[model samples]
Target chain A: MRENLLDVENLTIKYKVKNGNLFFNRYREFKAIDQVSFNIGPSETLGLVGESGCGKSSLARAIVKLVGLDSGKVTWLGKDWTSSHASTDRKFRENLQLVFQDPLASLNPRMTVSEIISEPLENYRKDLSVLEKIELVKKSMETVGLSTSMINRYPHEFSGGQCQRIGIARAIILKPKLIICDEPVSALDVSIQAQVINLLKDLQKRFSIALLFISHDLSVVKHISDRVMVLYLGRIMEIANVNDLFSNPSHPYSQALLSAIPIPDPIREKERKRDNLVGDAPSPIFPPSGCVFRTRCKKSTNICSIKEPREKIVKLGHRVACHHVSDEESK
Target chain B: MNRLLEIKDLSVVFDTPDGSVKAVNNISLDVDRGECLAIVGESGSGKSQTFLTAMGLLADNGRSAGIINLNGSDLLNMQRNDLNKLRGNRIAMIFQDPMTALTPHMKVGEQIREVLDHHQGLGKKAACEIIREMFNKVNIPEPDRRMEMYPHELSGGLRQRVMIAMALICKPDVIIADEPTTALDVTVQAQIMDLLNEIKTEIGAAIILITHDLGVVAGIADRVAVMYAGSIVESGEVFDIFYNTKHPYTLGLLNCSLSLEKKIDFLEAIDGHPPNPNNLPNGCPFNPRCKNVRDICREEKPEIKIKKQNHSSACHFELGVK
Candidate 1:
């Protein structure tokens, strides 16, 4: 049996917003993520996908201890790490890393590529000799398709795609057990995006590193992920295997999200039933009561507005959170 | 068929301290009224520069050669005021980032009204009424209520709608939407694209859609021009570009594109990054990345050749209906 590498339960993150007022102290709570739960086994990928302000980034951040979680339990290697997991052991920190969206901005402009790649190694592995650290950095750089000769060049000298390669090299230099990638290829062009996605898959296989891939691009999430989870306004809409989720979506929101992706094949695009979502996503601060997606859902009803729908397993390993799914099951 | 806009051998080059960068190679294409033309390419492919040069919106250091005739009026040699008059009044453009395209301080209604005020010389009361009508036309709920809000007050999707409203407010004959939905999410992108198409039909305006997403191009464009290294390597109808591609670079791009319909085990990525405009390679410019690269491709450039009715491609090898 494949052992679970990391398990997250009931993860919730909220922020106190001022609501654009300075004189008054009236604040409202914005639930960035609510009761989100998932697990990743060794060398597995769990893709978190949603639009902006859906809290996918916040959830990834919370998992890496970059942000405080309002409520949740993070279990790593059978050990529990609560909301305030900062100041934890360095081993835990070394085992988990993150790759951001903007490659150029994520890297340091002043630091040389070699220095930047080895910075993590210098911090985590104090016992490793300088020659060993250099060797590891060189191996990682080559692994991400970066040339070993241009190690002395700065970030500005490289293109957007090359800078992202350097970023990947740094993330994997420490040989972390898990990596949370936050829209890593969103800023890259199509050709460059393919290279980076393939590199991540290759590295994961070679090193057995679990990945938590968060992206607004559903197509990209589908390309590389083994299991996909759809998030809508701080909540999980559906979680299923890649084939099942794309083949048959249970939730209305998931259905809309899938049908909305523009198919590259013109014939399929013309024939497919397209559900064009009208109106914008409501403000996360004033999200509707009960089901957050009720306002945009076609299957919404009085029951949907009164109570948040519990997750229902419609098939093996396919869970959907929608009142309509429950109604069909009851029928 | 009447040509709404015509370009003859248009090229744009920018002068930098390092060297003169040929951002746009000589290219000529005509747009008909009520037709959607898509210019598809990766970064540094000169897709945006071609339109920006024609619109007289190029940077100060950039110089463009050739003729841009809008209704037989020479835009390249026209007076500054005359060119300015033609802009936004007859040829409106929608940018990629909606927030940056709009003024942060001004209200949404005022921004739309300002366009009408400057172009049509209409009074505030009259402009505001027209702006409200446009807001409703774009499907923004509570048009009056949302109009008073500032640009940042609205969400990304809402801001894009306002941009579309402003662009269509003038009722221009030609609309150049340059990566307008790139910053938007998929769901909102679909909504905006639907609105754009619906408005295009209602207004009968020619839309020049410049984007990199093949899916977007396949779905919306009637004709597509595939660009590579500051040149148009292939030009054809949408069906030909997708179903019967004729260029090696275009074939590479189609394989590189991720499709939700047909699932492939691995995407075939074009090996190298887009060439730097300042130092483009010799000969075909795409020879380095071309899969079927030949000895002749490395020695001489290939001109755009007509292979079928309304379809042309630049390549040294045979390519058609593969």
Candidate 2:
């Protein structure tokens, strides 16, 4: 068995919102992410899937300490780093990097490719000389398929795909053990997305870096992930191996997500029943009681709306949070 | 079948400081009544540009020399006033971002009423009643309550629904939705597509869905046109295009789409970025990226070659995917 490189337990996040009229104004807690827990092993890729406004970004920010967590334990390499300050968690920060959604916005326009890539190296290592830094930057650029000579050009000179390469270079310059990629390839064209995904896989295999790949796209996530986690209203819905999850999704939410994905072939589409999730996703501010997905679940019952379902071991290693599935299995 | 829109040799170019950037070059396609024709390509493939130019809606710096015949009228050379009369009345367009296209200050009901007021000469009371009915048709729940809400008050999906209702208020013969579902979530996208299909059939109007998503194209398009470098490189009946893809670029696009049905060792992506419009190559635009690129491909540009009764391709080497 592989060592558990990261551990998260009972992670709950909330924001304060004002409620009621002027005279009866009261502060109410808005739960963006409910009690969610998952772990990533060494060099493994954990794919987080959900629709928009589902707290995936919040979870990502919480891990990087960019935002404060309400209640949870986020341990990296057997060390509790959730409550740790940036200065105290310098080593952990170096080992855990984040690549954002938009590479154009993430990178500074004034900064050249070399400078953007070398910023991390300079921050982590102060003793490196100019010549050494240049060499490191050149090698890192080459790793992401950019020419060393092109490093002098500014970010605006490159295309969307090339800019993303620069972002990947910056994230990996420190050789982080874990990289939190939040929709890194979603901004690029399909062909360019393939190039970036392949580059990521090659880098991960060579460096054995664990990846927390978050995206709303199931196809792209299924391509590179070792295990996949489904999230809804800031809670974990299902976690299973990539192949198993795609083939036999246990959660109703997972099934709805899988069915909604438009397949390229019309023949296969005709054979498959349209798995439609009724109603828009419930507001995260006032999520429904019991199961968050019950509001949209086709198989919802009286018990589903009344009682919150806990994650139950469904398969050999897979776990799902749904009372419908558990009840069917028991019967 | 009535040809609602027929575009012939549609070439559009934008004048820039560097040079003329060819946005849409000699592309010919037609949309029939009650048919949903999807123009699919990556960004800058000129699918949207071609249709936009056909509608006589080019930017200030852009010019077009082509035949944009709409319902037996030459829309391209029509006077601005004449085109304006036809634009929102006989033909309507829904952009990708409804928030930007819609006014934030106006109520959702008033937006629909404004469209009617501009073209149909409807009074406030009549337009409001029509707006509420259109809202119900678009499947917007609590139609009356939502009528008073601003654009900001509605969700992205609902805002798009409002845009659709407003666009279809006049029951235009053609509806051009440019990436309508691009910003929306998958579930919402599905809902939108279903709604669009239902409305197109109900109104008997041709729908032109401009998008880069091949998956969406596969789902909704009766016919698919694959564009590259400001040209329609391949187009055919949906089944032929999906099962017997005839162009290198089209095949590459099919291979690039990630599938969950079978495990793939690697995604087959077309290498290299698309050629910049300003620095276009001499021959076929896809020659640089085409795997089967021959010596002839680099020397002469190939015209569209009709392979089947309904399928055509613009590649030097014919796709052997029988």
TM-score of chain B of each: 0.97, 0.97
lDDT of 1 by residue, B1-322 (tens): 7688888898999999998999888888889888999999998899999888878889999999998888778989989999888889899899999999999999999888888988999998888889889888888889989989999999899999999889898899889999989999999999888887787688889999999998888778889999988889999999998999899888888887887766776788889899998988888999888777778988998998898999998887776422
lDDT, candidate 2, B18-93, per-residue tens:
9899899898999999999999888888888887886787899999997989998899999999998899888899
**All candidates: TM-score:** 0.98, 0.97
Error of 2 at A84 (Å): 2.6
Off by over 4 Å in 2: A18-27
Report each candidate's C-alpha RMSD, comma-separated, in the order given.
1.6, 1.7
lDDT digits (tens) for residues A87-152 of candidate 1: 665668788888999999999899999999999988898899989988998998999999999988
The residue pairs that clash in candidate 2, if any, are: none
Q: How displaced is residue B275 in candidate 1, in Å?
A: 0.5
Per-prediction count of colliding residue pairs? 0, 0
